[model samples]
Target: MPQIFRIVPYSIYFWSNESDPLEPIHVHISEGRATSNATKIWITSTGKTVIKVLGENPG
Candidate 1:
């Protein structure tokens, strides 16, 4: 995993292998070590952000 940045107890990163279908340009955020169900933040071409909370309770 490539870490983009960290804030407090969270890590924002991207999986090197990525997903099979390949999501758009996105990053995952999670507490401590990154998880498979980490929240995904997608970046649109227009510079808008779309957040997807995997599993549950990513807050």
Candidate 2:
């Protein structure tokens, strides 16, 4: 995964595998590099972000 940005306790990124033609544009958020516990947010064609999954620590 390549990190897009970071803000304190959270890191925003996207996996390189996302380049697959079947995948939509989206982002993954996690505490540090624990991607197994990350949350997924899908960027809709309408330019909105929809939470696809909640992280282990939703706080």
Candidate 3:
């Protein structure tokens, strides 16, 4: 996972596995490296972060 940046308690990142292709630009937000409990956000071309899905323990 490549970390893009961090904001307070949330650490944003994305996986670099080429085996599974991820369409469109998106990011995973989680506290620490707990990706399973993170939220998924889709990035729009207009520079907007849209919430795609909320994790089981989303903050």
Candidate 4:
């Protein structure tokens, strides 16, 4: 199961991490049960906040 970080009532964030390696500091956002790619992200502050669109990987 994946963990979810709530940013607000309408938006949620999740960190991107893999088993072997992880992606550059990035976050996944969603409106609800929908896909994260549908959500847009914005970065605020230096090396502090990062917002971006969430996407699914093909296996």
The 0-to-1 C-alpha lDDT of every candidate, in the order given, reads 0.86, 0.75, 0.73, 0.47
Per-residue C-alpha lDDT of model 4 across residues 1-59, encoded as one tens digit per residue: 14356544444454445335644544445555535354445445575665444465221
Q: Number of the top candidate by lDDT?
A: 1
Tens-place lDDT digits, model 1, residues 1-59: 88989997889999876878877899999988888898899999999999999864344
Clashes of each: 0, 0, 0, 0
The reply for model 4, stretches above 4 Å from the true place, is 11-22, 34-46, 53-59
Query: How many clashing residue pairs, candidate 1?
Result: 0
Q: Weakest 10 consecutive residues, lDDT, candidate 3?
A: 15-24
lDDT of 2 by residue, 1-59 (tens): 67899987888988776544756877888876646557888898999888866547454
Task: Assess the local accuracy of residue 38 in candidate 4 as a C-alpha lDDT between 0 and 100.
Answer: 45
Tens digits of per-residue lDDT for model 3, 10-43? 7888876523555578778887664654777878
TM-score rank, highest first?
A: 1, 2, 3, 4
The predicted structure with the larger lDDT, 2 or 4, is 2
Error of 3 at 7 (Å): 2.2
Residue range with the least summed lDDT across 10 consecutive positions in model 1:
50-59
Error of 3 at 32 (Å): 1.9
TM-score of 2: 0.73
